[model samples]
Target: MYAALTSLHWVYLLFIILIIGVMVLRRDTTLVCIIGIFLLGLIATSSLTTALTGVFSSLIYAITQLLGTILVISIIVSLSHIMTHTGINEVMISPFTRLIKTPNHAFWIIGLLMMVVSFFFWPSPAIALLGVVLLPVALRVGLPALGAAIAMNLFGHGIALSGDYVIQGAPKLTADAAGIPVDQVIQASIPLVIVMGLVTTITAFIFMKRDMKRGILTVTSTDLQHFDEQMNQRKAPLSKGLRLFFAVLIPILLILDVVGMIIFHLQGGDATALIGGTIIFILMAISLTAYKNKGLEKITDYLINGFQFGFKVFGPVIPIAAFFYMGDAGFIDVFGKTLPAHSQGIVNDLGNALAHIAPVNTEVATATLTVVGVITGLDGSGFSGISLAGSIAHLFSATLGEGIATLTALGQLAGIWVGGGTLVPWALIPAAAICNVDAFELARRNLIPVIFGLIVTTIVAMFLV
Candidate 1:
């Protein structure tokens, strides 16, 4: 009876349904499932008395647990917004535009930089920064906004997220679930991730090259005006000295942060803090240097815009993250103590059920992991479904003989790389919104390259792993 009833975490299953319904039929509002989770979890506790107490308690619990991750994301996003409005971000991008002279260069560079930044910071925030700065230049060099956007989505969200080297998020969780060193998973995934990256990059470029020639293609000014308006404000320009200051200082500071992260060994949220603090200082320096008399007010007002930008980009995802987080053992420890110690949480139960039905052979496990990833990605947010997948991987790693972590990472890659935003209209909306492209069209454009990449990655994983 326990095995039968627990096969589906009723509340979590409800959250999934809630998310799908909201995305397909409802639309507009952010995180309807979170509210549903509160109500549903409350009612599951039994009586009206338990429902009343559990609802508020669960809400608080979810918020408290997710706060650190959320706050770091919010601050980084805020810093990115601050830099953009202040023109410091523009000054920063001015240098990159000088280098990427061709469409191929633009595609690879945008994809590469987004991967590097997003490895440290999550992709959603990083995409806004990359899109605002490098995206236009990519377009100017004859790359379609669709191509640039696709690059951002794939590298930033896919390869970077699967490895999660700096943040070590997916790796750490998988390692913990499998009871292995985080470093072990990291080491194992290096070659597999690189193979996937190469295959995906080549495929995406091939798809994008259909429109642009080897040299350059021209687009109408109206079709591409959004890129220019990125740093344009109706406000006044800066003085020569102030412009010179940002020109000289910003790169030095960013370089210092990069060097420090390497030397001091920053990981997880610490890396985000390092980048966020540096950006704030950069924001301050520019505000003061540009507007000496009004520096304080400008700084304060500018930061508000930054917060808005951060929230606008990531706000919807927080509730979604919160909802999915409930599927993890981390959050369950606190609110779910009512269950017996011997009882399993959502992740374990699902994994145990899977492992029991299907023995953990190499071929079976690899395919299972990849299929799980694809399924998880259906609701979008490739990262959302990973913790659950990680948990399942943990259960099977012991029984599956060799290469469980590799299978796990591959599974995670499929789910997020596709669902997170690369090929999904709902997930791609943010990138599409600022890039001024239609999300559905972008999804259609991305489908072929992305699918080809996935097939290649899956095949490679089977042989190699």
Candidate 2:
């Protein structure tokens, strides 16, 4: 049952506004988030001691909610490192190089492969897996390094990560915040993801081709030298035969995980566990084989590398996540049942209040969420703001009386497409570095296409909502 709004609810709304304002200015929200959490605890419990402890407690709760995602990502990155060092990744990706005979061939092939691989692992690791092996082939075929970076950024970071169908990390955060099922958000994202991916990538390809014709885009000697240097750095300790065997074996094992997910109907944490388990074993086996007696030491080294990456990526996210989690089920988890009886969480209570005072239409709700998502993404973490989007989507959806999953998916797409790596200069570094292109240039080339795609996708989401 719904209850009337209280100071707790208004305080949450005020902090949400402040967080959005900070994000729009492209500033860090961690301090703002910590203060918000402390204030929320203060208001709910009226105890300075409880409020102080609540900050740490909320972070623990957020981490508990997010640990599965962090672990799976860490494991995948660890496995990627081992595969790269042993030359298994190159062997796996080398066959795709045969498909690139021309510039057009290179763009689509590299993009499609990146998207598919990114779906299972992650865009960052997928970039490493495909970049070194394919960059030379793409360059030989006349595709500019900037063009390759755009393709990878749009396809892998933009498309695969926005949908995140297999990994479900993005959806899990949004869905939990929205008080909806993860599968519902994933299903709702399919059509929007397709539209956004097609429009953005095709528009980018056209612009790239036009630039080439105008002599504005060309393969550079510097890019080739960079690629050569990276290639030279990779000397696999494993024999050619061993590399080939593992390369073939790895894909089959990854495919089996997909098949297992479908057969067992696993989703969310279970699906991630399935993949994480497989990758851990893969890392151990490869480390043992590649290092012989030194295998045990190498496995720890790879995992440490992975955990470092995982924590680095997630560090900025935890505080914001902790603050937003309080809007939903996390409130009671962090601070006891401090609300009045019948309160349906802070976000829902605010939504119910807004519904009674001023009815919200679908168009306004859709546009508001798109703006909020884009603004939140401006902070450059893509993920740092999605939980906020989910909370706001839930609030608005409650007023509309429907379409929570669609709104959540739309917000997820907008935030990730903007900050996940495509439009953000800093976020684009990995693909830009790998392709030997300037990150700012890649972001510039991506701007028009991504904006057009977001506009189209927003309109499509309005209809779906």
> What's the TM-score of each model vs. the native?
0.76, 0.98
Best by lDDT: 2
Query: How much lDDT does each candidate structure score?
Result: 0.64, 0.92
Q: Mind giving the per-residue lDDT tens digits that candidate 2 earns over 1-465? A: 679777888889999999999998999999999999999999889999999999999999999999999999998999988888889989999888998999999999999999999998799999999999999989988999888999999999999999998778899989988989899999999999999999999999999999999999999888788888889988899999999999999889989999999999999999999999998998999999999999999999999999999988988889999998999889899988567778888999999999999979888888888888899889788999999889999999999999999999999999999999998899999998888778999999999999999999999999999
Off by over 4 Å in 1: 1-52, 119-141, 161-164, 167-189, 213-218, 224-237, 247-255, 258-262, 291-294, 297-332, 336-346, 349-357, 398-404, 462-465
Cα-based RMSD of the predictions, in order? 4.9, 1.0
Where does candidate 1 have its weakest 10-residue lDDT segment?
1-10
lDDT of 1 by residue, 88-172 (tens): 5556556777889987888888888888878655777677767877876777787777778778877887788777776565665
Error of 2 at 112 (Å): 0.3
